[model samples]
Target: MHIEKNILDNVNIWLTPTFDEKTQTEIKEMMTSSPKELEESFYKNLEFGTGGMRGVMGVGTNRINKYTLGKNTQGISDYMKTAFPGEELKVVIAYDCRHNSDTLAKVVADVFSANGIKVYLFSELRPTPELSFALKYLNCHAGIVLTASHNPPEYNGYKVYWQDGGQLVPPQDGEIIQVIEALTYDQINFKANENLIEYIDAKIDEAFVKSTIENASFDTPAEAKDNLNIVYTSLHGTSIKSIPDVLSKAGYSNVNIVPEQAIPDGNFPTVKSPNPEEPEALTMALALAEKLNADIVVGTDPDADRLGVAVRDNDGKMVLLNGNQTMVLMTAFLLEQWKKAGKITGTEFIGSTIVSTPMMLELASAYGIECKVGLTGFKWIAKMIKDFPNQKFIGGGEESFGFMVGDAVRDKDAVGATLLICEIAAQAKANGSSLYKELQNLYVDHGFYKEYLISLTKKGIEGANEIKQMMIDLREKPLKEINGQRVIMVEDYDNSTARNLFTDEIEELKIPKSNVLIYYLEDGTKICARPSGTEPKIKFYFSVNEPLDSIENAKEVENNLDQKIKNIIAEMQLQ
Candidate 1:
C-alpha cells in the first residue's frame, strides 16, 4: 500500500484549504483507509485529450470532479480571453442525463461568467448536437457539454466545441491543454457571476429542430408516415424528447417509444451499457419492434450524438445493423434522394473515417460525389467540412454509429440522423420496399462490405503502459501479411506516412498525426489498429468486401466476408 512520493504530494495538495471541505474529507478517508484508491486517484492529472477531458467520476485530480472541471473551465476561460483579445467572450454550456452533469455544467458556466464571459446555459438537459448547434447559432466563441458520449454511468466527460460547431481540433486542442497544464488548482475561479449567465430558451430548440427537418432529403408521405410503425428508445438519455419531437414534426404519427428506456436515467438501468454500437444495448428496442411489428427500430446513446438502428430484413425478422451498414444504407439513400431531387450539383461531397467501410468511397464515387477519409472521431470529419467550404457537405459519418447529415450541426447528430433514417425508411415503405431491402439493393449496386470491430480494454496505469507498448511493437514490426494475403500498403498515421510494402516507396499522409496503423491487403481487406483516446482500450477494425450479384447469395457472401475477418483476426493473433 506504499504510495509514490509524487503521488503522495499530489494527494496532499487536495487536502489543503484550496479544495472544498467535502473533497478534503474524501481524500482524508482515502489516505487513511484506501491508499490504493488514493494512489489511483492522484497518480496523475486527468489528461485533456485532443477533444476534451473524460474519466471516472470521483474526488481526485485524476478523476472527474468539481475541482478538475473548475481547473478546465478556468483554463478555457483564460484561453478564450487570449484567443480573442479585446472582444466580448461568449460560451454555451449544456449537459446530458449523467450524475453531476447538471452540477458540473453549472460550475462550468460559473467559471466562464466569473471571467467576464457571457454564458448561454441550457435551461435543461439537451443533446450534444443541440449544444453544438446552439454554439454556432448564438455565435459563441466556445462551448462545453457535460457527458461521456457512450461510456458507463460511473464515467463522465467534458467535450469542447469551437465557433464552427465542431469539437476542438489541431492547434486549438493542443493550445487549450497547454493553458490547462500551466495553471494550478488555486488559479481557478469557481465563483459565479449570475448576471452574465443566461439560460438558452426554447428558441434554440425550435431552430435546431427546424434545421433537422430541413436536412431531411425526402418528405415522408402522409400514408407511409402514418402506417410506418417505428420503435425508438433514447436509452435513458437526452434523445427521448428531441427524437420524438422531430419524428412527430416530420409527419410521422406511428412512432412507438420504449417506455422503460424513454425516461432519462444516467444509470442506464435497463441495459448493461447505453452504447448503441453493442447489439445488447438495442435488445429492448428490438424486442419492442418485434412486439409492435414495427418497420424499423432506432436507439441513441446517452448524449444522443450516436445512433443504432434495426430493421426487418427480408426474412421477416428484426436484425440490428452495424455502424458501417447504417452509414452505408443512409449514405446510399441520401445520394439517391439527392439525385432524384436534382440536388447533386457535382460539388456535393461526403466523408467517412478510415475505419469505416470502404463502400462509402465507392458509393460517393458512383454518384460522382467526392469522399474524404479522416482519422477517428467526428471532429476530423467536421474539420473536412470546414476545409471544403466551396464544395457542399451532404453527409459524413464514422463506423461508431455516429453520423452528421448536413452542415447545420457539424458534429455527429443523432437527432437529425434519426429523423433522416426514419425518412429513408418511410420512403422505402412508400416504394413497397424496406430499409433492409434497400441495403441489399445498395450491396447489389455497389459491392458488399462487412465490417467488424474488436476492442480490448486495458485499465489503470500498468494497462496504459501495456497498451502504449503494444502500439510501439506494432509500429516497429509492421504486419507483412494477414490470412494468407499479401499486405499491399501500411499506413502509419502516427508518423504521418503511408508506405507500399511491395514497392517500398513512401508518401506523406495528409491528415494529422494519430497513433493508428492501418494495413491494406491485396484481397481488398483493411485492418486498422488504434487506441482509444478517452477510454482505456485498443480497437481493431476489420473490413472485407466482395461483389454481390444477387440478393439470394447475400447470406453466403456475408458469411464468407465475416469468416475472412475472423481469419484475419486469428492470423493477427488478436483473439
Candidate 2:
C-alpha cells in the first residue's frame, strides 16, 4: 500500500471520529481485525476517479459517506463559484432508491446550501437523467445525482454533472479532484442554510415531462398506442414514476409495470441484483410478459439511466436482447424518425463508447450522420455535444444498456430512453411489426454485429494487485493471434497509441490515458480487455461481424458467430 503520510494521519483521525457511539463501535471492530487487513483498509484514501466517488458503504476514508460526500460537494461548490463566477450558481440534485441515497442527496444539498449556493433537491427518488434534465431545465450551473448505477447492493455513489448534464471529463475531473484534495475533514460544512435549500416536487416533474413530450417525435396515434403491449419493470429502483408516466403521456396506454418490482425499495428485495442486464433480475417481468403476450419486456436499473429489453421472436418465445442489439434498435429507430420528423439537419451526429457495439457507426453512416466514439464514460458524449453546438446529437449508447437521447442531457437517460423506446414500440405496433422483427431488419441492412461480454471478479486488496499484474503482463507481451487469425493492431488506451503489429505503424489515440488494451484481428474481430473502475472485476468485450444475405440465414450466421466467439475466448484464455 503506497500511501501518503498525510493520508495515513487522516485515516487515523476518521477512525476515531467523535460523532456517534455506533460509528466508534464499528471502527473498533475493524481496528481489531488482522493487521494486514486493517492496514489495507486504512492505508489509502478513496480516489475520486474519472466518474467520481463510487464504493462500498462503510465507515472509512475509502468509503462513501456523509463526510466524503460533503468534501466532494464543498470542493465542487468552490469550483463552480470560480468557473461560473459573477452568477448566482444553482444546482439540481436527485437520488435513486439506493439505501441512504436520500440521505446523501440531503447531505450534498446542505453542504451546497451552507456555501450559499441555491439547491433544488428532488422531493422523492428520481433517475439519473432526470437530475441531468432538471439541471438544464432549471438553468442551474451544475448538478449531482446519488447513484452507483447498476453496482451491487453494498455499493452507492455520486455522479457530478456539469451544467450540460454530463459527467466531468479530463481537465474538469482533474480540477475537481484538486479542489477535493484541499478539503480537510473539518473544512466540509454540513450545516445547511435552510432558506437556500428548496424541496422541489410536482412542478418540476410536470415541467420535465412536458419538456420530454415536446422533444419526443412520436409517429403513432393515441388509438394505435394500445397495440404496443409493453411490460416494464424498474428492478426495485427509481424509474417507477418517470418511465410509466412518460409512456402514458407519449400516448402509449398499454404499458404495464411489473407488480413485484414496480415500487422503489433500496433493498431490491425480489432480485439478487438490481441491474436489468441480469436475466434473474427480469424473471418476474419476463413471466408477466409471457402471460400477457406482451410485445416486449423492458427493465431499467436502479438509477433508470441504463435500459434492458426483451422482445418476442417469430417463434413466440421471449428473447433477451444484448446491449448491442438494443443499441441498434434504438439508434436505427431514432435516425429513421429524426429524419422524417425533420430533426436530422445540418451537422447531425450520434455517439457511442468505443467498447460499445459498432452497429452505431453503421446506422449513423447510413443516415449520413457523423458518429463519434468516446471513452467508456457518457460524460464524453455530453462533452462532444458541448464542443459542437452546431451539430444535433441524435442519440448514443453503450452495450451495457446505457443510452443517451437528444442533446438535452449528457448522461444515459432511462427516463427519456423509456419514453422514446415506447414511441418506437408504438410505431412498430401500428405497422404490425414487432421490435424483434425491426431488429432483424436492422441486422439484415447492417452487418450482424454480435458481441459477448465476459467479466472475471476479483475481490478485496489482493485482487486489485492481481488485476494490475495482469495488465502489466499484457502490456509487456501482447497477444500474437486469436482463433487462427493474425492480430493486426494493438491499441493500448493507457498509452493513448495504436500499433500496427504487422507493419509496425503507430498512431495516437484521441482519449485520455486509461488501463485498457484492445486487439484487432485481420478479419475485423475485436477483443477489448479492461478492469472496471468502480467494481472489483475485469471485463473482456468480444465483437464479431458477419453479413446476412437474407433473413432466413440469420439463425445460421448467429450460430456460427456464437461458436466463433467461444473459440476466440478459449484461444485468449478468457473462457
Positional deviation of 286 in candidate 1, in angstroms?
Answer: 1.4
Off by over 4 Å in 2: 1-10, 15-22, 33-37, 342-346
RMSD, every candidate, angstroms:
1.2, 2.1
lDDT of 2 by residue, 1-575 (tens): 34557645755677554334676566667656644445555656677554567888877677888887888999998898899888998998999888999998999999999999999999999878778888888899888989888888778998888877778777888988898998777788888998999898798788777777766656568766777788999998888868778777777788888888888888889988888888888899999998899888889999988888888887889989888888788889878887887877748988888798878888888988899987787788888899888787888888888887787767888778777777777778778877888888898999888999998999877889898888888889988988999999999999899999999999999877888999999988998988987788888999999999888888999998999999998877876
- For residue 104, model 1's alpha carbon misses the true position, in angstroms, by 0.6
Local accuracy of candidate 1 as per-residue lDDT tens digits, 103-218: 99999999999899999999899999999999999999999999988899999999999989999998888888899999999999988999999998589989999888998647
The global C-alpha lDDT for each of the candidates, from Candidate 1 onward, is 0.90, 0.83
Clashes in predicted model 1 = 0
TM-score of each: 0.98, 0.96
Task: Estimate the overall C-alpha local distance difference test score of candidate 1.
Answer: 0.90
How far out, in Å, is residue 414 in model 1? 0.7
TM-score, candidate number 2: 0.96
